[model samples]
Target: MFTRHHALRAVIVTGLATGAGLLLAPTASSVPVPDRSAEHALAALVSGPPAAADLALPRDFGRRFGYRPTLTQGLLGDPSGSCSSPVPLPAEFTAACRQHDLGYDLLRYAGRSGRALPPDARRSVDTQLGAAFEDACSSREEPLSLASCLAWADIAEGFVRVNSARQDHAVPESETVRSIAPGVGLGLAAAGGVVLAVPALRRRVGGVR
Candidate 1:
């Protein structure tokens, strides 16, 4: 009777060990992962020197709004469009911009430090804004007006740190990953979870490891 019980217990232990071991192992069956990086880009319609040039002015104006239009708009609502346009910044975006100023978003080179970024944070800012504008205009032939251009530029630039949530539906990675590390970490974490869940059963073949 005791022998019979030990055999049953061993069989159960083997099954469980095999299952958990599989969890730690790599699986041959894998899901194709989606790529999501926000390398600070925009619509391909807004590309080239001319589009870049046209987009330049509005972006400059956006930065002038204290290099914080995006941050401000993200946190507090700017109904007056005081920063870049008369068109109010969206309520949610205003809060985000505000959060950015509150040290929610850390700028690497824009300021002396992440918390105490300089007010005249222009050159680096302009470059970031410019790159965003250039991306938005890459594919389209239309030229965004100064206000519209600034609006888009603010959204794109601040997005680098403001972090947008990812959805199952695919959109421009440029827009989504503007928040930097969050997106990268989010992607990697998700991939890790899936990768570690099921390992390749045929790693050694013919038997479970």
Candidate 2:
């Protein structure tokens, strides 16, 4: 029989176990690599004096005239690409994901072409993605939906930040996509077991009362 003290202990244990599960949970998957040809095409398009001209176009210019065909093509190739996260993000996140992909593509292209961008450049891009996620989440109309969206946004941002931390900015992104180590999986499983036990403990405490 569970006493009040035992019930409180179970609650505390459940909280710790849940925290461990979260800490050990594997990060989101790696970003998908665009094709080499697509990368080169995008790189060439963004290079040269005309690139400056392209940027000078209004933000809405691409929406009107297909001004940024490379971006369109890239998004077309991977429409649902939410930074390779398996999480089901809100529809509003698509634009942010597209922009994030463009940023990463630029970094990858630069690295492959031997004109590697500074490490801070990648950090800036990742930061921008996080902000974009917040913006997207804030746009939700309903309060509960907004809160849920924000939570998912945090998860997505956390995944990318962890991924960015592991990356070697000096090299292309292709070299950085790696599977999580076995130890993390074990910890996650242990935490899950503890969390699963909470309901049984709660039932025992309720019966005693």
Report the number of the highest-lDDT candidate: 2
Off by over 4 Å in 1: 1-85, 88-104, 107-122, 142-209
CA lDDT for candidate 1? 0.34
Best by TM-score: 2
Candidate 1 lDDT score at position 176? 32
Write model 1 residue lDDT over 88-126, tens digit each, in one string. 332333432332232212222222222233322222333
CA error at residue 86 for candidate 1, angstroms: 2.7
Candidate 2, pairs of clashing residues: none
Q: What is the TM-score of each predicted model, taking all chains together?
A: 0.19, 0.50
lDDT at 56 for candidate 2? 39
Error of 1 at 171 (Å): 32
